[model samples]
Target chain A: MELLEYGFMQRALLASLMVGLVAPAVGVFLVQRRLSLLGDGLGHVALTGVGVGVLTSSAPVGTALVAAVLGAVLIELVRARGRTSGDVALAVLFYGGIAGGVVLLSLAPRGQATNLDAYLFGAITTTTAADVAVFAVISGVVLAVVWLLGRRLYAVSDDEEYARAVGLPVLPLNIVLAALVASTVVLSMRVVGLLLISALMILPSAVAQLVGRSFRSTLYLACGVGVVVSVAGTAGSYYTGTPSGGTIVLLAIALFLVVTAGVALRDATARRRHGRQVEVHAAHPHEHGEGCGHRPVPHGDHVDYDHDGHLHAPHRTGTGTHYDEHDGSAHPPAAVVPPVGRERP
Target chain B: MTDPAIRLAGATIGYGDVAIVRDADLTVRRGEAVAVLGSNGSGKTTLSRGLLGLATVLGGTVEVLGAPVGRLRERGRVGYVPQRHTVSGAMPATVREVVGVGRLPRLGLFGRPGARDRAAVAEAVEAVGLADRLADPVAALSGGQQRRVLVARALAAEPELLVMDEPTAGVDAASQAALADVLARVSAAGTTLLVVTHETGPLAGVLTRAVVVDSGRLTYDGPLAGAGTAGPDCHHPDEAARPPVRGYRLDQPRPAPDAVRLRHGSR
Candidate 1:
């Protein structure tokens, strides 16, 4: 309880709370774009910024933000210029950033390397009011950009080519998104450290995807998960004398595992219930042939819905061999039927 | 007749400095439904993309709705459906939300969708016959259903000209029929269609003309039936409309074809 009495701890909690909400909120876009690890890349660049800060005796957070934003822009430019493949370019920057940071920090005064390490594993207890201000500004900007460009972001993320084809400025939108992600990484590194910051960005959204029904719902739930984890993990760390950053990351991961297990359990139960229904139909021959045409003539499309309101694969009998009785289409019968979650729109 | 919905005269379409489709000339008048047919690595997609400014016009002029392709500012008036691909895997959106993206161009800078946008999205979804699945996550739908959602997205824009790449490449007969049905309705309503595909199948009924592209050249540009007749001999009677295949010149090094690949990969 006395932890709250300390002004520094109060600052730390507020900063963590802001970082927690913003990281995953922006992280949703990263994950959707399959750029989940881009945060880690930007975080490495931010560490180099810290090294620059320590060498020049400037504000570490400010320098890190600059370095990260520049790195983000460079990456976008490289991808845009088509000088090299995206993965290759990102790989170069990812390693270059860390190596540069370590080398720079090593060349600095004796204690500066440890200060960089403080960024690697975070030093939340030392959070300053200035850090909280950075967090608030970063949060406001990230949230505002997301709100304003949310639909465009979704269209671009959904299919970049289609977005471009329809006249959305895909390149500019991409660079802006990268900048936002870079800012988020810098804002979060002070509370979660460079190494663990991406976890804050990616894990809550990953967990939310398992339970939330839609994209907007998942985003809402992800932010909720992040805030809960930040507050609860901060309290846990204060009480148990553990590192707050690692504790929060681990707690987020634990929540992900719990949600995954819950989804798996529910699916298994549904399958067993479906099996029972099939068996009951088998008991009475008349009930089977009408709607339960195990190998229905595939002349027309047949859609079967699962209890969860998702499409099920075409029904088949014990023969395990299905075919279109009349047309003899070249495509395999099962392949012709649409399976749940395999659509390519 | 009104000005063509799309026209490309002596256009060389490519990415950056490399040309994929060279000396291409084509036109589709308003309300015409034409299919661009080509094999893998052919330039059908490139030509369509060229009109949309996705593919760079290396030479000559390209126009859509009477505006230069590069400066075509009527964004909402031209709807484009790209090749079948996963929209989003990590963040699954409902069918409505996915279709709602079609309204983005109309919303403009600093504007949000209003009641009109909602009505358009709903109508588009209904047109695709997925009205029942409007609120369901697109990931839960079949591949055919997902493709329909994409069509719905394009339709929501209420574009005068719709350009689609491989709308039925991997789709089933049922879904293809449904797409053809919707496209028929769209065509009847005066929307021109430029569809790129290898096999017309169900779309055969709706296609008024077909342009065949082979090795970055227009081999045949005539009746839809002429596309099927395109063979090794390739004696397309319509010489004026057909661009001769400018086969590779051994003296000159071939332009690297990787630009299209790179562009697609980046996007």
Candidate 2:
């Protein structure tokens, strides 16, 4: 509790909470759209923005925001015009952003190179009051936009062409969504950095999906999981002297694995129980004779004799007695039915 | 009667320098249900894309709803459903939300959806029999259900002309029948429809006309009853029994002897 009273720790906590809230909220949509890679791509773009800020002796946050937004807009344009898949386009953009950043950094004067290793790997210890204020503003804007247009965004994301046909300004809405994702990436970059940001975006939401059955529920659960991971990982890092971003990512991954395992185990157990019950029901037909016992014979059985003498067999069953001479002789007789209580002789 | 809902004269369609369909002239009247029939890679999609302003017109004047194709706005005037697989099915949205997108054009820039827009979305969802699943996630739906959602989305726009590119592809027979029923309702309501498809079995009786495009050229266009006899070289001989021939062409104008010989063989 005393540790939580410290200014730096409080600042880190506030920043982590901001990231935890925004990342998963956006991630819910990204994960559903199969655009999980966008987080990673946008993070790399933000890194370039940071690099540009350092080289030009400008505000890193502002430069990073501008660069990330530009990257987002470019991605949207390329996706709309070209035949490239979003993931492929994102990959190209990500690598290009990293290469450009490295080049720009190398060209800068010696003292101007502020060595962005801390930003790249993420160091919550360095977060300032100004950074926290900027994060709050960004988070508030994103949340407000998402809240206001959540329904429309949900519609457009599902089927753009269909959405357009219905009269949704799908192109503009897509741009808006891209921008939101970009901003989220930029904001979270300070906490998780480029390399591990997507894990924060994707892992918590994925875990939430395992427990959540509906869209609204999923969103809530994801937000909850994200907050928990961020708080826990931040405390663990401070106390155990571990890397903050790496620890948070690892914690999220651990949560995802545990949830996935739980769901898988539950499903497997249910299936096994279902199989056993089916077997019991099949063997003890009298127990469910009035209800489910009337189900047709199991598919593998060749003959289904009625309560009477006539064999109720499927047409595919090639019993010799059921063959008609006029029937096209395309198939050979494969089954023989014996007279009840009598040998062939 | 003076201007048809859609008209294309001497239109050549292709991607980059190579032409797949060339020298085609076609017209579709208001309230007509036209089927574009062709085998795979026969430029049916290209023709549809050209009509929808997605593909470049290689060499012809194309008009939709009395306006130049290039100038026509994709608003409530024209609704389109591309091939089912063309859009991602795993997108995160509910059925109602998907249908609501149909109203985007009406909302215009900086305009929010009104009560009327919400009503139209609901009506469209009800029309496609997806009212019960309005709140359901699209990704969780079956393929046929997803197609229905798309159709509902198109219908919500309340277009004069609805263009469906392979609407029934990858759907079950029951869903296909349901789609046919929906199309019947749409046509009965006086919306012109242009559907590009390979299998015309379920849609036979209801289709007002048939158009066939091959190699970026219009081979046949006219009444369904005439589609069978429209082209001497048409592969689907069975089509002639259903519709009248409104127009016919070949990739290369056939020599008189071969045309005569082919005509004789078809008879």
Candidate 3:
């Protein structure tokens, strides 16, 4: 409560909370598209925007938003083209952006008040009331779009080809999603910093996937995680003289590890309980172990050996090590894909 | 009000510059259960994609349910189940959510799913026999069940012509039987069916006629029993004498993307 007595702290807190809410709300779709690095890419380009603002005596945030959106559009255009050289295009844009930013920032007048580190590593304490107002508008727009078109966006992100076949305006929705990411990147620039924006967007959503039962629940859980970490990380940064971005990301990663451990523990106990119900153990002359000439399949907390095209799990009883033949049905079909080279028909 | 479910005249379907299906000609009356058979590297899937307006229409005209593919405003009326669809294992989407997207086109972009939409989704899920697993994540489903989910997704659209590309591919027999059972119900309910598959297997009983696409041509079109004679590798020696299919390329004078968008704007 004492932190709110300061105008700057209140601004930082408000901005951080908006970034917290908006980052993961848009991020779930980005991660779904396998574009987790997009936030980072936009963050890199936003630096160029910052440099342009400083050199030309304009608002850094506005320039950053424009630049980030341009980068987003480029990424979307490449993606829509569906070519193999896309990675090269992305690398060029991101690297070229950073180099350009450094050059531009260096050219700024000698008496420029802003430090590059503030943008790179988030000086949450330096947030102005005006910046907070802008953050409020951007975050409000992002959240409204997500609310209105949640299912449509999910459909397009989850399965683009299917969505298009079903007539969902795949290209337009893609552009909208790109714009959302761009706005989100700029919105998050001050709280989590440009470099660490993706972490804020991705990490919470990643953790939510581990425990969420459905898409809606996962989205809600991701937003909840986002808020908890942002607010706590902001408060924690105030207490300790640490960068807000690092503190928030570290807290997010710690939460990720903790939730991962809990899920693994729960799965292990469930597997054990399930194991107790089954009594049959396959008798085989060749015992399966490390370096066994069999395909190792990951089966939740334990590795299942693919024995003669069948999955085998090693069971340890009071007797000794025995390989229990797990049903072939347990394996994902992608693992046992029928012969390759067959045309899609 | 009355048009064949599908009508293709010398259509050559392909992607980009390469043509896969060449000079395909076929027509199916309303309510007909037709299976398009072909082998690997054959143009069957490409032909399917071309007719669905997903791929480039290299040549000729394709009409589905009385309208051109892209001009068909109600895209939900043409349900499609893609081949070996994994349903995006990267994210956590429940069966309901996955199937729910199938209704989006019919519901319009801005409109939310109403009770009727929800009922349609539930009905579609139940049709595929995944009613109990509606709330469960699609990632947890086995490959066979995922295939069923894809079918349910298409069925949710309530399309007049339900085209399923290789539904039995990579699927176990039990699931194929389940799929066939659902198709039987859908067919009985008067929705046309266009199935593309390498292995007919359990679906053989459901298909009344077979149209085999070999080397991008309709080698045979008749009863299901004769499909094996003109199997994927079976190409006639005189096929070379046939005229080439007219092709349209990007460099060619094709309709611009903006024009296409303008047409789709009303949709």
Every candidate's CA RMSD: 6.9, 11.4, 8.9
Of the candidates numbered 1 and 3, which has the greater TM-score value? 1
For model 1, report DockQ: 0.37
- Please give me the total number of clashing residue pairs in predicted model 2: 21
lDDT of each: 0.77, 0.70, 0.80
Tens digits of per-residue lDDT, candidate 3, B45-79, equal 77777767787776677788887777637466889
Task: Give interface RMSD for all predictions.
Answer: 4.3, 14.2, 7.4
Q: By TM-score, who's the top model here?
A: 1
- Expressed as tens digits, the lDDT of each residue in B1-267 for candidate 1 is 377898888878876666888788888899999988875556777788788877778777788988888663655578988776445557868888999988887777557999999999999999988887788777666677788889999999999889998888777777888899999999999999999887876798999898988767888888887677655223244333445445533222233243333242232
Clashing pairs counted in every model:
1, 21, 0
lDDT tens string, model 2, B1-267? 456888888876554444556677988889999999875556777777777665666676778888777552644478888676422533334667667767776665545779999999999888876676677655545567678878887898888889988887777675687789889999999899999887777777668899887544577777777765544325466344444322333221111111111111121
Q: How does the DockQ of candidate 3 come out?
A: 0.27
Best by DockQ: 1
Writing each residue's lDDT as its tens digit, candidate 2 over A51-81 gives 8887888888889889889998998888877
For model 1, the superposed segments whose C-alpha errors exceed 4 Å read A110-114, A279-345, B16-18, B230-267
- Candidate 3 residue lDDT tens string, A24-49: 99999988988899889988998999
TM-score of each: 0.85, 0.77, 0.84
